[model samples]
Target: MGLALKPTDTLIVIDLQNDFCPGGALAVNDGDTIVPLVNRLQQQFRHVVLTQDWHPAGHISFASAHPDKQPFELIQLGYGPQVLWPDHCVQASTGAAFHPGLETTRAELMVRKGYNPQVDSYSAFLDNDHATPTGLAGALRERGLGRLFFCGLAYDYCVFYSAVDAVAQGFEAYVIEDACRAIDLHGSKAAAKQTMVELGVHLISSDDLL
Candidate 1:
């Protein structure tokens, strides 16, 4: 039998934007395939939140901003090791928009991250610096949400980090495995799964939530 969603459980859809989907600047493999699954999952929860990777042009995370740097290259930023990416999800650009096929009318909140030109954000609750918060934690707590179920694009990066942070912030965190796709850069997907397991973030499939 599937686990039932409780009233205190919230679904967080992470970075289901054009740039993360297939045919975009930093496309993830089969990233668009999760949209329909996520749309259906939204109906199972009472509270739904969506996250957007809204980076500014010339953002520090963009490889194009640095001479001789390329996407996926590692760089030492003030926060920590950062993976430079193709200029994607620039604010107000088409790539920054949510996937056209995503059904978001039921979303109660939308958190926009990575807008800071100086620091890149991966977790919806906290920026890479680990000091600045996106205010998601407070919002969830305000709504009395005690558990978070995540589903969306780029599982190895944003989705993974968000689930980690969700547990760190004192909420039960879960990742809907089949409802997400990974970039898997240099085996990041496997590494991320290991890290998430170590952090006590539960991994489940969409069917498990039914």
Candidate 2:
């Protein structure tokens, strides 16, 4: 059965950049594997939005910014627990560029996040502070898009958070399982799934959508 897409549905592709793919500074396992599926999926959606990590050099989220910290280490920031990542998507750097393999031309809007040196942004809707809106919600609302279908890199982080925030913003959200890869650090993937269930975000696979 083919998945029926409504006129109000929008596909949000999160952080499908080079730095999150194979051989990336902080690679997620099999991250590149989703590119083909995402490319195909884009053809099925009328409205598509892509997100870029787009961090600046020496961004506060980088573990290298803190002398004593190492990548993947958790540090307490004013907003909450911040994951110290390796310097990956530095702005204007090749690593920060979208994967050449991705079909980005079909996307209607491209939202750049995590640009502020003082804050880390995982969800495309808002910065980690949860106060600064990324204008994504407003864009969707303006377009009258209500149901958000998400797919892209790092299911446990960006994709997960984006889906949660979508619901919080009064949109029906769904995550395409096979089209996302996860860092899964210390059971984060499992925890994210549980949280999504509680928040009423639907977890589905591309097969279900097909």
Candidate 3:
């Protein structure tokens, strides 16, 4: 998302798309359940930003794209161990489109990632290696938003990584846990919560904001 809009303590919506919701190619567990809460939260935050996973068809993250690799299988990328996904989030595909349930009107900026055929991006702030940084932090900083609120889609992956990177980059970060679902890959949902606890990231329910 470009930072052209008036920003107010930027609210980052991470990965709210069809492929991550139920009945899509790579659905998260109970992913659609968070849409209502996210919609509600959008009403409270004015400077809303959204991240979309706009992968090319047969991008490197897909198991099908890599012969001998299978979905949920791990492979060593130049970055490190990466999990292959069921072909998903293809750009312009129905599964890659923003989830219809997402309240898009509130979003002033919608950042699309994972489009690079060679790189898979989980965090809005960085690609998987943490080597490349997306301009989210800089944009938020430019807008004088030192504090950021996060909600949407997979709690364990995008949401978790985004929150961690936000805190690591000196932005106060808040995660609305109730507004996110999890992939729970090998019980990652629990691990993510633990990591947040250890990182001193703030965790709150959507009710806490009300």
Candidate 4:
């Protein structure tokens, strides 16, 4: 039997910005293909939240900010290991905008993360250091929303971190597999899935919700 969505359940569409889609700066593999599926899935949820990767130019996470670093190279920041990324998702830029074809009218909240030039935010709920919050947890609690279903670009990073943080915050967390795509850097996808399972975050399919 399929799982039924409830009023307390929320669908978190994460980082569906132009930069994460094909032909953009930090494009993920087959990321654009899931848009239609995500749009259709959004219709079934009572509460929908959207997340954007809104970074500033010269953001610490960008490879260009480091004199000798290259994209995909890892560097140690005060927050810990940080993956240097190509310049993308600059605030107020085209790449920072949501994918044009994505349906957003139903979203009850839009949480923009990574806006701070000092920190790199992958999880919608918290910054990369895992300390500074995006205020999403409090907002969801205020609305009495507990169960969270996550879907969007770069499943191995943003989606994975968000779902893990959801479980950490005492919410029922699930990741809709088909509605997500992965950057999968250095086997991170497999590793993330394993960690999520160990952490009690459910890995499910969109059909399960449908």
Whole-structure CA lDDT of model 3: 0.85
lDDT of 4 at 43: 93
Judged by lDDT relative to the true structure, which candidate is superior, 3 or 4? 4
Model 4 Cα lDDT, one tens digit per residue, 1-210: 389888788999999999999999999988999999999999999999999999989999999999998999999999899999999999999999999999999998999999999899999999998899999999999999999999998899999999999999999999999999999999999999999999999999998988
The whole-model lDDT of each prediction reads 0.94, 0.94, 0.85, 0.95
After superposition, which runs of candidate 2 have C-alpha atoms over 4 Å from their true positions?
none
- How accurate locally is residue 13 in candidate 2, as Cα lDDT from 0 to 100? 97
Please, what are the lDDT tens digits per residue for candidate 3 over residues 155-195?
A: 99899999999999998888888888888889899999999
The full ranking of all candidates by TM-score, starting with the best, is 4, 1, 2, 3
Worst 10 residues of 1 by lDDT: 1-10
Clashes of each: 0, 0, 1, 0
Question: Which candidate number has the best lDDT?
Answer: 4
Worst 10 residues of 3 by lDDT: 1-10
Which stretch of 10 consecutive residues in model 2 shows the poorest summed lDDT?
1-10
Tens digits of lDDT, candidate 1, 1-210: 388889989999999999988899999999999898899999999999999999888999999999999888999998999999999999999999999999999998999999999999999999999999999999988879998999998899999999999999999999999999999999999999999999999999888976
Segments of candidate 1 deviating more than 4 angstroms = none
Candidate 4 stretches greater than 4 Å from native: none
